[model samples]
Target: MQLLEYISFLLLSSVKFFFFYPVFITKEDYNFLEAMTFGLTAGFIGSSTFIFFGDVMYQFFHRLALKKAITHPPKEKKQRSIKHRRLIVKLRDDYGLWGIAFLAPILITIPLACILATRFYHNKGKILGHFMIAIAFWSALIYIFKSSLIHLIS
Candidate 1:
């Protein structure tokens, strides 16, 4: 029963991590080791997947959009324009790995991350490394906090 629970938790965590970390997991689950592993893997996989498949995903979407447009063109004008390019650049410059791995999940979805990576022309391997590092940092923080809380409570 306990094993099942743990496995369920891990699977849930992984799914949630794919979309958003520090999200699906509850406070009760925040043991030091669990927190560390969750945060690290979540951040790494989430961002790395985004970065690696970013361009490919973008192309796929683009093709889809084109097909859709051909079939049924939208009447409304596009909302997002080139104006935000500078802001994106600034974010890329300032936050870099942290921005993509940590903030991206909060601000945008995995698909969006892939889109942004494509737009920014980020290198696949480098982005993966950055994501992994960011995950490690986030996981470490979670672990430390959980450990402290456990100590206090026990």
Candidate 2:
């Protein structure tokens, strides 16, 4: 049961909600080091999954969508989509990968950040490194301030 919980913690941490899990682990009588290690490991696994497989998965899904497409797209929807795309491009240009890295663990999920980094930066090592750095930073911050976060949550 304990082993399963640890695994669950790792899996949950991989996607998001990692920040809140450390307190749970500590309450389970695990040490801070254990929680930090699991968080770091999960962050790496999550980021790596998207960094390597993101494009392939996206292409596969794209093909699937194309197969079931509507013959004629709505003109108003197309115009709205064009505006959204321009906004996204502008934000991407302004913030770049570092912004994603900084916000990944806290605001953005690891997979999304990794996908964005892989899409725009095209540097696997750099993407992974930045993500790990962000994870490490957040892990340390959260662990140090767990009491405060828990209080705030309550």
Candidate 3:
């Protein structure tokens, strides 16, 4: 029952973000190796699913939109808010796809980052590699700091 709980927690966490796994596993009394493995697995599975399947969803929606356009015709493009436009432009111009990939696992949800990466880059391998590096780095950092902190407090 405890193992099942831990597995379910990690699976859900991977779909959410990589940042919380170290803290979560430590709290659950898992060792460093178990924490690292579970954290990485969660991140990899979530991101990989989005990277491959997300594009298929995107195309399906895009084609749907195209078909709708043919039947209904198009309207004037809606004016996007300046803030929204600026943020998109900034991400594209300054950060680009790599920046999103590097920050996605930590800052945003794994699936979101994967979707953004899929949208920008056609090379799934490159995005996956970068995500793996980011996940490893974050998982180690979280585990080390969180474990040390726990010891200090206890």
**Candidate whose TM-score is highest:** 2
Which has the higher lDDT value, candidate number 1 or candidate number 3? 3
Model 1 Cα displacement at 27 (Å)?
6.4
Of 1 and 2, the candidate ahead on TM-score is: 2
Residues 111-150 of candidate 3: C-alpha lDDT, one tens digit per residue: 8778777877789998888888888777777888888998
Question: For each candidate, what TM-score against the reference?
Answer: 0.64, 0.79, 0.78
Candidate 1 off by > 4 Å:
1-30, 80-90, 145-154
Give the whole-model CA lDDT for all candidates, comma-separated. 0.60, 0.76, 0.78
RMSD of each: 4.0, 3.2, 3.2
Candidate 2 deviant stretches above 4 angstroms:
18-23, 70-87, 148-154
Q: Number of clashing pairs, model 1?
A: 0
Give candidate 3's TM-score. Answer: 0.78
Please give, for residues 34-142, the per-residue lDDT of candidate 2 as tens digits.
7678678888878888889989987888787776566544345567778967865776788777777878888778877787777788889988888888888887777
Model 1 reaches what TM-score against the true structure? 0.64
How displaced is residue 148 in candidate 2, in Å? Answer: 4.5
Which whole-number lDDT from 0 to 100 does residue 18 have in model 3?
55
Using lDDT, give the best candidate's number.
Answer: 3
